[model samples]
Target chain A: MNQDWTVIDGLQYSAWSREIFEQMHEGGLTCVHVTIAYHENTRETLTRIGEWNQRFESMPELIRPVYEPSDIALAKAEGRIGIIFGAQNCSPIEDEIRLVEVMRRLGLMIMQLTYNNQSLLACGCYEDEDSGLTRFGKQVIKEMNRVGMVIDMSHSAERSTLEAIDYSERPVIVSHANPSHFHPALRNKSNKVIDAIAANEGILGFSLYPFHLKNGPKCTLDDFCDMVVWTAERMGIDRIGLGSDLCQSQPTTVLEWMRNGRWSKTMDYGEGSSSNSGWPDSLSWFGDNRDFPGIADALSKRGFSDGELSQIMGGNWVSLLNRAATPASPFLQHP
Target chain B: MNQDWTVIDGLQYSAWSREIFEQMHEGGLTCVHVTIAYHENTRETLTRIGEWNQRFESMPELIRPVYEPSDIALAKAEGRIGIIFGAQNCSPIEDEIRLVEVMRRLGLMIMQLTYNNQSLLACGCYEDEDSGLTRFGKQVIKEMNRVGMVIDMSHSAERSTLEAIDYSERPVIVSHANPSHFHPALRNKSNKVIDAIAANEGILGFSLYPFHLKNGPKCTLDDFCDMVVWTAERMGIDRIGLGSDLCQSQPTTVLEWMRNGRWSKTMDYGEGSSSNSGWPDSLSWFGDNRDFPGIADALSKRGFSDGELSQIMGGNWVSLLNRAATPASPFLQHP
Candidate 1:
């Protein structure tokens, strides 16, 4: 693995501690997008940001906040990991579109419109009817574009995500979802979704979550790398990167909360028929933050050139964020 | 008309003026539920309340705020109209269920879970699919019950309304919708909804909005009184009252805001095929605040006894509010 590569994981919601921060540093992760809100409102989200401020004050050696694209380089230069904030659901804005800028100013770089349930903004993957981007959803997308917040369609329904890709002025991203062509999971995106993202010059970060893999926890490194190569050949290597939907050291209750916020009382076993309510086991090749090197090694053995492998590892996401995280007042053109 | 009766209109969104207050006083209205929010959020709703505070300060002789059922009597004694604030949608509370108690404390006596669109709480009448009360909706209903904030299902879908009526420990109210059996408007309730309210010892407020009437603006007062008599026969007279969804002296754009808000860019000419996106003509006889006497006179001509007419006019709503507006800490069971 090249130590100088800007290895940025597009999404992660691991239970954070000094140990995980140390692991991120050891894995040569220059930046990581972390989930801040699952089902929290504006005030509650503000409190969470306040807690992050305290953490930043306390953990200067291992981590720092990433509000701008340049912050990743700053973190790398300082020998620390840049922790970028993102939201798994749009509940934080709580029906007000104006809060899109507020969240952006508060260090949110990415936001998913829905998380496995229908939100005011967009239909979730689990909703029976995908009415596409709602009236409010359109308005929010416009505001999110104006604020330069990356729209993540990882958990949105097919119609909603497709419509959002068409409706948004900026390029959208499937921030942390696998291709349905490989796994056919409920949360996975179909080839049509990938084609639309590729057409729109958007990025797709492949998920390392076990349920998204073809063989779940027992998925081999070779098979995983092969899938990546297949996706790259189909969608272009410039549009692919690692999201690694890792959930290290978190309890089962967090998974329950992630799948079933206050929006559902009954446990919604989101994907298949097994009814396993807890988090699925991590894949053997990528169990923790420290396992990125193993994936890089596997990709190298799969005959990807050093430059193409670098793009897949992190350079592609860095390029996407360089265009996304800037203020929308004077936005740069797509590469 | 009997002057001794406590006449309370279940719903109104009048363009507030001293002249309307004078008409309310002249019509012998003791209290009127004035809509303070349609799509406004918590902060905007608080500003509206603050504006009402100023109105109360400046027009003490004309109108006073009604925080409880007893305030109706106080306004009657003072020869002023009692103005009770209510929200037409749950947008004011947003996603935080705890705001239920806060709104109640701020003199919001009634709140509709949905206003012609799907909300975080429940499905509105306009949504294609009605999944019933959401998980958050159920929790908010419980909090509303505990705080004695009346749940108004006027704009909710059938399944959501029925579920709310069944789930609520406190009696729910269809605060401003007519029976769909009489007029099959999208906003009207069916016999099943009316029966549920009647069975729960709740109240049904027959709307006087032209769109809700049998023949729009041309509906005869005799026909209106006949519908009332028919509804009273099905859901006992004790469970029925006048809501009269009046939009007196409001401009056409105000109606646009009420129906569309920031939710839609295109004008949603709701409930009809006609492109007349404005306030429809008020019914022939009942046009404004001064027309309550005409309704009473017409009902009298239709052979309503004095006690029954009085109940239809306002007594039933007063009784309903007496149970609804009090804090649940010391609630009295209904007969």
Candidate 2:
């Protein structure tokens, strides 16, 4: 098993910017799955996504886009942060099915079926009745498989999550969710759902959303590791991984934008207010505490082995990435 | 034409208490389309709805549930407000399609298709794009038509609006939109779209979200009148009406919940610290302003004929209520 000692982030919402790239370099991150959007967007907004790709391409060799699983080795050889751009919401592709490939070419490697709510493709995690995938949502899952983007079901509801996992030829990833066996309400995945994914050999990246933690925002890095360990016990070691959803920079400036609740759009940047009442003093999400090795050290303290350590740190993601990689078939380009 | 005002408030959302009821009695409001989810409670929400029937049924002269057009005249003779008990969002139906009739039989006469963004039935007015109606939404619309509830598309998006309007064998409603001819954007409908409704013999409502006005927060009552006049000229006076969108006692406390960049279930009372710099405001919302009569006066002053004024003020809605009056036939009841 002479694999690269790559630290792959299965999922994160960090700013896909130079500052974050710099932080990834400093944080010992060899790869990161940066979420884009799986929400609604106008055509003009979708075009700007092309502009987003240009920015990813602009980063120094310290970071390069990873499409095929083979790109990981090449990036590791250079000791660069492999930025695997993904969409938190799928609104960028809008209703067009072909843009899936256009996005793949531009390096969108993974996509959640929905964000905090419903999209044309699928139902979200919080929708009351747990609507399975809509007719279009099922199409999206198949397209996700055909295009080889890892299907991330982190924010999708139980029925939708199960349907997506069942529809996907390759196993999907619950890229960032907390164990529902521990807590209930807005941010936890159901146990039945976890068991189903475990059977499918899917990965579950435990989230750091304060609401997902039993201690809420007061949970320390130690509590975060405990959650990881607890989830692993329930969902088998190989089916679990670390997805430290840390952003390199916490814009004290942008918290109000979140209050607008749209998360991405700059509708009222200066006019909104924020209430960070749930933040734990021990936690730091902005650039200062984005240390990858620091998180690894916490997992090690929780009795994680070099194998489990390497798996969560990056290997599992590499394996999943390999499984989801759609070989560039020149013969099937158009027909 | 001696239909002395039945005073059917097309829609109203405010915390219900003995005080609010007294205000309704004071306002000479014979009936109101009161929102169950936005305000009111389970203890007496339906009890209050049933109370309207018992009070009116007992009097056989005053307040009653206006399930048919003929109920208005009879209610006015008795002197009670017709309570069209309903929900602002179908979220309470959660995801069940059968609940449509159970709630309808329980006095849930009108339902806004989607509140502000996405629901199973259609996209909200606030969504970036309307994914049109989902299969469940189509089923819901058909069931609504069958069950005899008026399909209010006031808060729905452009695409969802058109699709729902077309799918519904019964004419639907733009229950609370100002015309783009007044102030164009997401909240206002285009002449073409309004014309489509008129062609279907459906109704268009004038809302008071200040952001949809010419000067937004600076808009005056006269500006509101201008919108009504503009819609009348385009959609015909007979088809135009007032959705007033009045939140009489609550002071528009739910605006924050709507700014979730979409309609949200989580309630955030008070002016939300939101990122909707671009969202519509309430120059017209008057949240707590009971001087809604002033808007009526403005319409009267603007030379809306006493006949035309009466029609726009509430007659058109009465006609829609009559048309949408859950048909009594089994075909109408279970279409």
Off by over 4 Å in 2: A1-4, A38-53, A56-58, A248-290, A327-335, B1-335
Query: Which TM-score values does chain B get in all models?
Result: 0.96, 0.80
What count of clashes does model 1 give? 0
| Ten contiguous residues minimizing lDDT sum, candidate 2 chain A | A326-335
Worst 10 residues of 2 chain B by lDDT: B38-47
What does the lDDT come to for candidate 1?
0.84
Model 1 C-alpha lDDT per residue in residues B242-269, reported as the tens digit of each score: 8988889988778778878998888788
Q: Who wins the TM-score comparison? A: 1
lDDT string, candidate 1, A1-335, tens digits: 89989898989988888899899988889899999999988767755765665566468778888877777888889887888899999988887766675567567889999988889988999889999989999998987887789999999999999999999888899988889988998899999999999887789998988888888988888888888989999999999999988888999788777876776767677763446767787676687888999899989988999999889989998888877667675321110
Q: What are the runs in model 1 whose C-alpha is more than 4 Å off?
A: A272-275, A330-335, B1-335
User: Per-candidate DockQ versus the true complex?
Assistant: 0.01, 0.01
Model 1 steric clash pairs: none
